[model samples]
Target: MTLMHKILGTAAAFALSAGAALSEPAMIYDLGGKFDKSFNEAAFAGAEKWKAETGETYREIELQSEAQREQALRRFAEAGLNPIVMAGFAFGSILEEVAADYPDTKFAIIDMVVDAPNVRSIVFSEHEGSYLAGMMAAMASKTGTVGFIGGMDIPLIRKFACGYVQGVKAANPDATVIQNMTGTTPTAWNDPVKGGELTRAQISQGADVIYAAAGGTGVGVLQTAADEGILSIGVDSNQNYMHPGQVLTSMVKRVDVAVYDAFMSGADLETGIFTLGLAQDGVGYAVDDNNAALVNDDMIAAVEDAKAKIISGEIVVHDYMTDNTCPVK
Candidate 1:
């Protein structure tokens, strides 16, 4: 080939490479709404952090219905989004179905696993964080009883409940835990009215501390707890500030970190199951000014010691999703 022709060929290849690099990352939020102040919000925070740091925008979609999952995934892939990040387990089947159609596209999913060469499944050790939160709830329960409000009656939600119950039992074996599920559908995650009613029922059963793993529904749980003058726990994000002194603490799962890392990794992001546990700083209980006075030195110390043991493999929080049974309840 002539020298000029060779130079032109190389220039064309460079242009194609540059175009691929410029393709923005994308995210599809779960059904509870992007600003649900829980799971979806955490993912949003991560995407915003990436935008702020890199000054690059990303495509985003908030799923309003279950039917939208497959459509959203296909649209993003067809548009050539380098890496599409999803925020919930509900997207698992859809991701798997759509992933096969776009073999070259990289996909990242949080809280669920999609077995595909091009998909990155990010699951967190929520049981570990829930255990810590349970410890605090048990310690702070003046009534010798605590409560757990789950969004859906799924195994993942049960895992959260099981972990919390174990922590509560570890701290106070005699402590009573009252558990309730909002519903068995996606709407369960966003129904604050139902959550408030459930909180009232738990309080009637002598619960003084409540931990909510119900996404947006948790907002109602926190509000009712605050209004009723009881301690409550948050989840997914650091939501202690939601009710300040009324909130005891939050079981923080670093979904934000997972999303941020996926975005930063870009086209070269790793594919496969990425599990985040105490060892990876993927999950923990939050302590901030919102509830600083509520978390005593002893409480903090005990949780820290437990955290260390968990990291060292001395403690294993039971994941209910594994066998669908909780040792504590």
Candidate 2:
């Protein structure tokens, strides 16, 4: 059976009985919950896929507060959950603390690097995918301007914004790309109202197409963009179906694959730093029936050419994390 827990308080603990068998895997979602329709949801999809294919169940927890990070990890480890996977980079420090205590238990963390011997760090080339989304935005814009809204003002989110600016300039050097961040705290991931406000603000600045790299907040960005009769880009998942043709495309990140691979490996999962990028099929843009009408042949051919060049090392999408600087604007 699948064990699901909603941890609302830091004092709350996983209800596993003492000395429970060390068999099933466990997942710990970030503060945005499992159904945020973005990053966490992607991870949930992977876990569900594993359950459907193997007829096996895993344990999971949707954390409700930042204080629950270490608590959830420690409790799950104590319960003998092997190959525990966490869905955010916020777990890096806490995982560092907990992984050493349970050297026998394997752990996997997405979006952050925790150099524990028993931990697997899964990171994505978000900049590369964002570049494609930006290119599409620039190509589709009617006002010669685009926008980007990110969730936390961290290096990771800036990575998305930086690549987007570069792609916009690459497509139209004269194009204007406006950028904003939801906030500096984790709450930035869930505030949709602020996201909508940012969308309108960008639209006022002549941004006819906006790309949202926020988590749940991106939902507001997409909704507001559609309500205002403009195009929006999604992140971390294929969100095209959310608004049909109104959504230009989504920068699809394979968070599901990372979770599925970890769950499939069970206790024997490999532990190392894994970076998924355009070449590894780790990140790319989504094209489906929902938004097929918006993408033209020219756009597809240009994006495909850029993708090939990136994989072949001819086009280097600058990683913002490398130096916290974007060569473009």
Model 1 scores a TM of: 0.92
Give the candidate number with the greatest TM-score.
1
Candidate 2: Cα lDDT at 221: 98
Per-residue alpha-carbon lDDT of model 2 for 98-156, expressed as tens digits?
99999978999999999989999999999999888888888998899999999989888
- lDDT (CA) per prediction: 0.91, 0.90
Off by over 4 Å in 2: 1-22
**Cα error of candidate 2 at position 165, Å:** 0.6
Q: What would the TM-scores of all predictions be?
A: 0.92, 0.91
**What is the C-alpha local distance difference test score of candidate 2?**
0.90
